[model samples]
Target: MAQSRTTEHCVQMPAHGAGQGKTAAPTPEKQLNCFVRCIALIERLGNALGTLAFTWATVVLLGGYPTALSSKDFRYATAIVSLEAARMFSRNNRLDYQLLFRTRGAVRPLGWNGLTVIVPAAIIRIVLASLRLGSHSYYGDDGHLDKRNPGDKTNLVPSLNIFYGMVLGQGALYIAACMLDIFSFIPQRSLARQGGYADDDRLLRKISGQALTMLAMDSVNNCLTMLRETGYVFIKELTSIIRVDRYRCVAASLLRSMCLHAQQELEESDQRELSYALREVLERTLIADGAELEIFIGLSSQICKVIPEDLAKELEDSHIKQRFVMRLVDVLNSYTEPSPHCPGIRRVILEQAINMMEHDSRYTNCFIDRHMAEALSMVEETVSEAENYSLFLGDVGLMEAREPLSSLMARAKQLLAVR
Candidate 1:
């Protein structure tokens, strides 16, 4: 009877499987992680392969050629290739802009960067030919040779022409690949036409400031990599300057956008949204404290410049509006230190202040004057006999004195007095 009862007992299992009614997958986050990993992998591989190729080419050609290939030359080539690959991969492969365009039957190309390279290369080639840089130099039967041969020199002109042609040829191909990328940005016909040609400045507007800022950082890092490969101090500095400028431009633009958003919110009588936007702008400006303040301040100044004087007056008249200015001053203090003509971080802060001052006579005459005076005082204290210039970008530490760093405090007070 017990055996009969046991035989009737059933063991059940779900048909679907474990986690059949599982939680939703983190599809977006997972994809983002994968994308980032893929990019990093590609970049690493490109850098390694590019350096190796350049090194190998230089070594092999040094013995066989009259003029050895310089590290700078090889590095430049590698940088061009690496950046080109990255731009292409980002635009077409990863983003799937091509596929999206096909659905709509709208496609376009970007040719600006090619023009950028070609123009520079063309000019350099012209200068080289005029100066006869590689003339009278050759690799002959035995070894390297330098001789004045009129006929050879005449023939060499064609060779030089060919060299320039090669440079342009490479530039052209690179441009073609870049043009393929244009489709990604040009989704609608109106958007594409409004965006203008590849070389047009309007293209900058299509990219968000945050996106541009990220790109700027990447570009800087790439430039550093280039510097290590090339070992040319001048080029490295040039790249650094460009990177810095790019950051400033993006930051400033972002600030302007934020201000516009805030203005729109105010116009719509959406106080909650206005407050949210203002808070966001303030947070961002403060976050940029570690960097130069030019972008942040420049953005503020730009906003002030464009808004009607009556609105500006209304804003200044209100406590809420004054809070915005105070927020700016606080950010400026956190972002910069005092210096003549405001180099580095100071330059950005001061430039923005000056720009804002230029727009309103009252701000120029009163508000900025007071703030400058206060800032000067802070600077004086910061640069007393002890000369606490050790720390920069405004990360002041605690004082051991019970009286609380009188000298530093006095400098700050003095700055206020001056203003």
Candidate 2:
């Protein structure tokens, strides 16, 4: 759906790759005297990337795998890319501009009233590196006071305590900055702008709230999956996966929401903007550098859902429905990721396709198009394999009486066959 999450946040390089305007054209006085443009550009880069790094870490290190896919991740990444984008972050109270500037964005503000924030952080880090505080100082490899000569008065290296404190401080500031990114969201005012009334704002809030809630639920569920009761954990996991679908259902609902919202509520300009935003959200959530099968399955299900019906008669959707579905079908035809662990996606991808065919003539045409037949067959195999794996576990000492994979798989297969 998107080339990268960081696209929105890209730093404005001075005359290199940024500012395509006549007024922005560099002058000899601006260049030779103080390097003002260069300094400002560096400051902007430092603020954007430095601040966003904390938020990005909260996603990848703290949240799900392929963390770049989430809207939350994009939200932060966009901030990191540019100062103009950063303005958007602060425009709707999406971020605390003051607390943020004091932390990662500047660390220590400088220049004419916070025009450049990189000065203090850049200076401190530079000084630390020069002192070689945590490096090969006079104390040698271990940096122990005991190993150093008492008579060596020339040893001007900083104490290990000071070095450790500096290192720890860096980490502390990062965590604090991460707190800002973690709490930020697509709040009601983020979408509510000129020409958008109270009702529109309320609707936007509702939609945003629902999307955010779903994402939070997924995050909680991902965390929950890590925990297992003492015994029969393997069988329990398999059984749980049998009656499941997560992302597919989410994508379906979101697609439905986006189309309906665009059709009913927005003006032409607002409609395009809102639709694009939703698509980007979809792209950010589903498409990825390390795209998961579950996401693609979710996407595929929604494609099946979207193609069959005209949810918005006048609302023209761009790229989301058509291109991605073709890509999804192609990917599914070649999808090699293990389905035994995340069987929910395998179940729903087929189910959505099957369900769509029953009501829509267009869906019937879609049923036999492209490489869908092969994709469906592959999905069916995954279901069969997952069922077998679950049964094998049950057959072993890891048995559970209320087993569901067998019956579930049969029903799925029956439905698939009927389609």
Residue 169 of model 2, lDDT score: 48
Question: Pick by TM-score: which candidate is best?
Answer: 1
lDDT of 2 by residue, 1-419 (tens): 11111111111112333355655544322222122222222233334444444443344323432321224323422333333234324332222222222212111211233323323433443344334433434444444445355444232233322332333344334344334333332222332332143464333323322222122221222112111111213222222222233222333333333332223322344333333333433454345422244433443343334333332221136434444446446655554443433433444444444545554445444445555666665655544333222111112311121333345445434444543
> Which residue pairs clash within candidate 2?
9-81, 9-82, 10-81, 69-284
The regions of model 2 sitting more than 4 angstroms off are: 1-278, 281-293, 296-322, 337-344, 384-419
Backbone-clash count (model 2): 4
Model 1 over residues 1-419: C-alpha lDDT tens digits?
00101100011111222245688443322332233223333333433433343343334332332243334333433444344354344432221111111111111222454346434533443343333333423223323424564433233334433433343344443333334334334332323343233432333332322232222232333322222322323222222222343333443443343343333322322233233233333335555543334344444454444453533554555434555556556654663433321223333344345545555545544545447656644544443322222111123321122222344344334333433
Which residue pairs in candidate 1 collide? Answer: 110-179, 342-347, 373-415, 373-416, 377-411, 377-412, 377-415, 378-412, 381-408, 381-411
Supply candidate 2's per-residue lDDT for 313: 21
- The per-model lDDT (C-alpha) reads 0.35, 0.34
